[model samples]
Target: MLLSSLYIIGITAEAMTGALSAGRRKMDWFGVMLVASATAIGGGTVRDILLGHYPLGWVKHPEYLVITCIAGILTTGIAKWVIKFKGVFIRLDALGLIVFSIIGTRIALEMGLHPVICVVSALITGVFGGLLRDLMCRQTPLVLHEELYASISALSSILYLSLLNGDVTQTYATVITLTVGYLLRMAAVRFKWRLPNFHLESETSAH
Candidate 1:
């Protein structure tokens, strides 16, 4: 369920970007469709291999690729309108991160991974795919920026694990962890919250 939802969000983000490109790049419909598919499935492909899942998720289900292509084609016509909604991508991205993180952690735990490994897997599931998409688009990933993006995912995964260990209800634990992660991301965006950079300039004195 989590993978499916994230896949949709990834495709949507790709389609939205491709659609809004103003046709200056001369990409035809097929090119746009290919880009969308790459963006949506790139990260999950890596995760599935790490988890030892054969054939990958979207590969085993060709419908995901078809749907992503259709979405890309549709976005080409409505790209301008979609771009006008400034917060749409950011909001959806946050929600996707929350959902995917929780689901990834849960799956890891079910597979008998240690809690720390589960948290790491959750972060990978949430952010790695998007990172690959951004790199493909020749842009810096938002997660690697100063923004508290991956931090929120990491914290949420930790929270979910702690709650699970405490015997909290599975459904409630998942809901709370996702909610916390989403709200934290939203707040970070609203407040321009960021982690401090380590680089500092020092004044040099001449004798």
Candidate 2:
């Protein structure tokens, strides 16, 4: 029940973010809904395809799709408010990442997947939606450039799996992972912590 509620919140938040991206591109309402749905559910769709999990989440629960569309349209009306409170969105995104990661991990575990596959599933579920949103918006994908985004997702999955292995209750494991993952993401943003960049300067210009 708790996970279901958090999953709804995560999709709503993701949808709003996608709406903002659509607005930045000056897209019409239909485009906003398209991007919003993609941003909210694309990750799960991809994960399901890869895992051969029948019946995607949104397909099984069409209300999830409806909720995302409604949230996107609402965001259009409150775009200014959302932009003004950037910190709120940042926090929401962090929460959503953890929530999505936990969901992914849980699904993989239920399917009896290997631990590493579960981690990969979590990473894809937590990050690919944003990747799709960015690609649609013609923006650089944040997961590719941001501080510890995918890493946090992987870490969250690993932590959750570890806790389960250590005989922790699922609820407690989830709460612990969510708290730690959210804080780590926020701290990464606060401290500008990032993986090393690989840049190659043009030799012709140097010459």
What is each predicted model's overall lDDT from 0 to 1?
A: 0.73, 0.95
Compute each candidate's TM-score over C-alphas: 0.82, 0.96
Go through the candidates in order and give the C-alpha RMSD of each one to the true structure.
Answer: 3.4, 1.5
**lDDT tens digits, residue span 87-132, model 1:** 8877876887777678678777878888887888788877776676
List pairs with backbone clashes in candidate 1: none
Those runs of model 2 whose alpha carbons end farther than 4 Å from true positions after fitting are 202-207
Predicted candidate 2 versus true structure: per-residue lDDT over 1-23, tens digit per residue:
98889998899999999999999
Candidate 1 runs further than 4 Å off: 1-26, 200-207
- Residue 28 of model 1 has an lDDT of 85
**The best candidate in terms of TM-score:** 2
